[model samples]
Target: MISAPPPRPRDTTFGRSTPDAMQLSPDIPTVELTSLLGGGREAVILHNGERYRLRVTANDKLILTK
Candidate 1:
């Protein structure tokens, strides 16, 4: 029987962060997801008086919706 090929590993680097090339700007504040979500899968963000829902999908990707 024919079988499917093995799945390739997901690239979490987002095509930017690399060893020796990784540099974060001090101007922008960094916040960890753990601290932001407080160990939850979702968090609500308030921006410009609008409410947005930010949640992690089943595939472990993030999604934001109004």
Candidate 2:
């Protein structure tokens, strides 16, 4: 006896030509360090009852610590 071929995957694109239509949100929320710190070198962020320190070093690099 001959067996049938496996079925092809369904198309979830909904007839859209470009894949960009499947994207959720086009924009992301962002915060600049200088703005968050208010021109200061360091700032503290409280998340989920934990404290995180964000700082800018003399070498112009960002550092985050718990």
Each prediction's whole-model lDDT (CA)? 0.82, 0.82
Write candidate 2's Cα lDDT for 24-48 as tens digits: 5658655666788998999999999
Candidate 1 residue pairs in backbone clash: none
In angstroms, give how far residue 42 of model 1 lies from its true place. 0.4
Candidate 1 structure, TM-score to reference: 0.62
Query: Residue 17 deviation, candidate 1, in Å?
Result: 8.2
| Backbone collisions counted per model | 0, 0
By TM-score, who's the top model here?
1
RMSD of each candidate? 7.5, 11.1
- Superposed by TM-score, candidate 1 places the C-alpha of residue 10 at a distance from the truth, in angstroms, of 15
Residue 31 in model 2: lDDT = 64
